[model samples]
Target: MMRKTLIIALGTGLAVTPVAARERQITPYIEVAQVLTADLTNDDVLTYTTLAAGIDANVQTRRVQVQASYRYERRIGYDDRLADADIHSGLARAAVRVAAPLTIEGGALATRTRSDIRGAAPGVLQGNVANISQLYAIYAGPTFGSHIGPVGVSGGYRFGYTKVQAPSIVSPITGERRDVFDDSRSQQAQASLNLKSGTVLPVGITLSGAWVRDDASQLAQVYEGKYGRLDVLYPVLPTLALTAGVGYENIEISRRDALFDAAGQAVVNAQGRFQIDPNGQRRIDYNFDGLYYDAGVVWRPNQRTQLEVHAGERYGSFSAVGSFTYQASKTVAVRVSGYDGIQTFGRQLQTSLTEIPTAFNPGTNQLGQNFNGCVFGAQGGAAGNCLNSALQSVSTSAFRSRGVDAVISVTRGRTNFGLGAGYANRRYLASNAGPGIIIEGLEDESYYLQGYINHQLDTRTSIDANVFANYFLSGFGPQVGVYNIGATTTLNRRFGRFNAFGSVGIYNFGQDQQRSITSIQALLGGRYSF
Candidate 1:
């Protein structure tokens, strides 16, 4: 049977500094790849060739920092004998110190990726299929803060927009495709004031408040919320501190539902009846308003180790937050953390953008920066690596999640190794049903473990290998359990400004009660940098 496959990819990049002493650089790059794919199971193989080009630029100074990148890809498939697809991705971020005590920051991200529904549902998948959608998000805000005498004050207003082109999916019941696109816009304003800088107040006190509003189209869901919080801190000793915080939050969501007639067809009126909310009311399913409080201790005995632990009540539920970090030596480090939080689909994607290196710059390498440091350093710098536990796709509704992450990395004479693990439990707040799809309230538990090792054979040669396994469990209709395992090894040879590498990877994903997929691929490529 023919299966989807990405065969070989080759890329080259060039970097240039515009001015000698100024911290400004620009890089332009291009890549070409060949893929062998099948749109469905037991289908004929189709050969596809793709070409991509991008530019990355960054400027940094004492008072300003900006980074941006843009990429475009065009693909041609032999089955159609035409360039049938064009893909674009871009990200930009800027932070400027408008004044000594004031700053403005903004960021925007746009990406196009294959939708996860194709794999989650019962269907044959192809890497080069047209099941692609774009996700766009932008946020801008200004923050001003300063210390006057023995008190400090700060405030900011932020505006954000998130848009996703929800792809049509084939329904298991009707076997017909339907559209389910949605968009959301939100605004948030916050302010805070604190005391005890130099007033000998015995304990530091901070007061903060925020207001947020979100409006979503298509789903006709509107959310408004207000939050107020107060925190106090006291130093018990030179290396330890006691911390406590109390907060109140209230959120409201507009009602949304589909109305169907006796004929099993959606009812309609002059105001786009089938698509509009019949009765605008509040949706209790999305309500999460209540009072919460927490108390925690922070310990920082030295520069190499720090720990924080807190336990609290949230909306009548138990909640906790904690983090621990330890630098075992100059070449080893460890980190562990856990948190409970409420999140929307858009917010989760935004969080992933902050943790992952999404920039397309020539020098931006996630593995090299987080895992294989010894390749560029003498004794290898002490660096910590964390597993990315973010959801792969944006869900249609908001959810609550509790998760923990941990990682350990060590570098020795000529070898570097790292291990990481993460787990999360998520509860969806809403259910959705459409022409071809039905999603009920879901509670999902996911976990993964990954490890990597890099070894230098000689001055110009190195080998790196990594493996990971992920398992997911979900409750409700069509209760599902799935696990995925993948491994890859690569050997690299350096030749001044050019490098040659060969890699082989194997991946397998399967559900306990259904079909499974396994793939193997080998690639040989060269990269040149300037």
Candidate 2:
């Protein structure tokens, strides 16, 4: 990893280079920041500090330029002193303007993260190992313009190779053991063109298209998707106008192998699996498919007001959503949105989205099959034999939901404040098994609401408060509600430049599931820029 001092030192040297070019100049800069955090939970004491720094430089010469950057960060404090950092990412671009006004540039990306802290809970983890999606990429872009009509085109493409380490855990039922599946990698590319009517049409248009793919062994292979968009803008008067657009997308998943562990076992011995058949590889079998389309409109009567409405639907999945927003002033806005669809509710998905289910993970799902301890059937035979029976019982149904949101704020020079609220209700049906027959699971509904506000006392002082709460109503389960409140203040600039600040906040949550927890945390940090 590249340290801040090293990067800054290098930049300083590069900036002082005696380049005898009148049209070329080198710009270099660096930023360093550190944070100290503390946990105030009654049962445990957790403390930590993080330090981060980055160095960037840009050299512009005539019609060509180059830019590069490097960054490093460390996490220290609490029960461990470990650090994480990104070595360095460097890129150089060369472009020449042609008589037709065309230019092109290409670059590369290389970054990785390493940690030495132990694993724990979310918001409380002390390690960077939890995130292993690290890798490199190559990218390029081109732009063209000419007298060959009144149109211009610009586009870019990028391909990357990433390494990901899935969490080491088994599905608790079918006893399917977890193992390194594949070296996952994803690809994305995009292009767009703009049209202008210098002496003809009074409006302009832009068209764009994009494609992406993510491959992860038998799990998420064939996750390739494509998208397209068209945008139009028209001016009714000098300061008034209208805008509209439409978009479409498609995504699909491929079939793959499924792994299963021996009965009563959660993990297969590394040595045993390798020797069992010398060719025995685990696999999950299922397909996932879907697509989506959307259309939107925007109207701006004047400078201080605007209105937007959007609608979309997903085919095969039988789902649709609509939303609208109105902004009356600089600090006040309200939005309403709703949806009716079937959403995959679990983390470990088993089959294609088209295959919906009633009870979660019908029989022995990916998670269940991996966790061999639970008995999914009465066969009492081999563990893998009972997985099919479990999946056969899965079911699916249509779900509908509606929600409304609003925001208000007051601001004057150095002081600013705002509050917002939102509410939503979602209902869906599920299926469950009975003594001698399968029973239809009742429809379930949940409601959620949240709000927040903040104010600046002066150029060097500020305070903010916020709250989030939600309630769930289900037919098979009791009514449940959860809420949390928090506030923080800074004696220095809220998020100053080259300054330090400290803050403290608390949160509490309760649910009908008999689970309750409360937590408070404090933190202080400082930054320096050049």
Candidate 3:
């Protein structure tokens, strides 16, 4: 179909091929699983069977490379109240090098996630359409870098698209329908010129300009930002440098008014979103233009360790950002990153997809279901496991988000362990004169911790274990806070080209005081791979 081809072409054009071993693999597989789930709070039990088939591929050539995974699933159950049979979950990226210094890079992701922050936790809400939504995002662009004599020039332009599919959700407090994100288009462009130290002068000088914009269909929202900066780098030692940059930035976000009938009542569309007025005037929601500057230090004593830290001011607030990566030994790696920015749910998803490493080990459950909330990758700066954090509540209003995430991986003999943790805070921004006024001044905060361990029982058998805990605070709905905790373990054995697995998990979710719901599930499954 047209959709399948677009994913391939765009993924190839936007991927950055990392230095890796010579690997080319294409695996097609099928699986059948029996599942039994119980809801302790409501004393309800459901049993089902799922049949799934999928392909996993990685192909690398001299001029082209690609990595992708796709699957189709069907659920058979007597109770189909929440059995969403169509579940798509995967991440892909590829690249094609047309010239020595020029390449097209891109990535794509498809998954289902929660649409509202106030919805029940996903730990036990599988296939619940009221709280779940399907998402698809793809991005690709061309990048080129070359030196004209002593001056180095580089530039890039990227186009991104995101779509969300689900019905409108009703507020628990007001019992009224509200709009969620529908889709968005984003564009980013950057160009820079650099002159290294000692080649033309005693110090290095660089000039760069960048622009980014996002247009969302819901309420016809638009956000545009532009900035130009001049940076100076002074070498303090062979492996260390002090850097500073100054720039001017302009940013604005605008949206059109929601439609209203002659009776002065807001109009609601069939999909639960508010209708937009065709004659509505676009009103500015946020506007800021001023100086931007930062000072930073870069340290790289060896190829295995690197660190960059910066402190600056933006949008009339003090800002701090940094990233660190360290390869302790052949079996240990650590990475940490801090970020501050304003973004909508759509933009956040696209940025997270682009950051996912081109090389990764797909995370799956005992039922062979992907989107286990995270992706595991090799040691590097791009090896962020923050997709789990980015998969939070999706709202129509744009918000200023701040967060920091850290990941650590270790391997010891026959066992491997990984840990990841993060915190995020969002303060919503809404137009006072438009439909967005309802969500103004709303705030939400989240903290998450996750850990996993896997042990090889033998040559063909292993056990995988994972545990997670999260706490969330929201001011958008009647419920003030919620906490979710869960643990799962799977035992696997392989026989030639066939594999079998069994898993058990217990999840608990609590909202408002001690009002809690508990879910327990067990699964048995087998797969044959060719």
Name the best candidate (by TM-score): 3
Between candidates 1 and 2, the one scoring higher on lDDT is: 1
Give the per-residue lDDT digits (tens) of candidate 2, residues 293-352.
Answer: 444455566644455444555443333344343444433333333333322211011111
User: Per-residue lDDT of 1-530 in model 1, one digit per residue for the tens?
Assistant: 00000000000001111234237777776655554543233344455565667767877665766667766667666664334666556666566779987777666666653233223311112343233456677776777778777778777666778787654442222232322435677676777778962266888888878777777764566767788888888889978888888888887655367565567565543322236536644454566677788888979999888888878787578888777867667567666767676655555444433332211122222111222111111122223323244443344456676788786767788887777788877776664543322343567677767777888899999888877777766543455676667666778888875667776665666777766766554545555544
RMSD of 1: 8.9
lDDT (Cα atoms) of all candidates against the true structure:
0.56, 0.35, 0.72
lDDT of 3 by residue, 115-164 (tens): 66655545453434245667788888887889999999877778899888
Candidate 1 residue pairs in clash (backbone atoms < 3 Å): none
Q: How do the predictions measure up, each by TM-score?
A: 0.75, 0.46, 0.90
Q: Provide backbone clash counts, one per model.
A: 0, 22, 8
**Over 4 Å off in model 2, which ranges?**
1-42, 46-155, 158-184, 190-210, 217-220, 226-250, 264-313, 317-411, 416-485, 493-500, 509-512, 524-530
Sort by lDDT, best first: what order?
3, 1, 2
Measured on C-alpha atoms, candidate 2 has an lDDT of: 0.35
Kindly provide the TM-score of model 1 when superposed on the true structure, using C-alpha atoms. 0.75
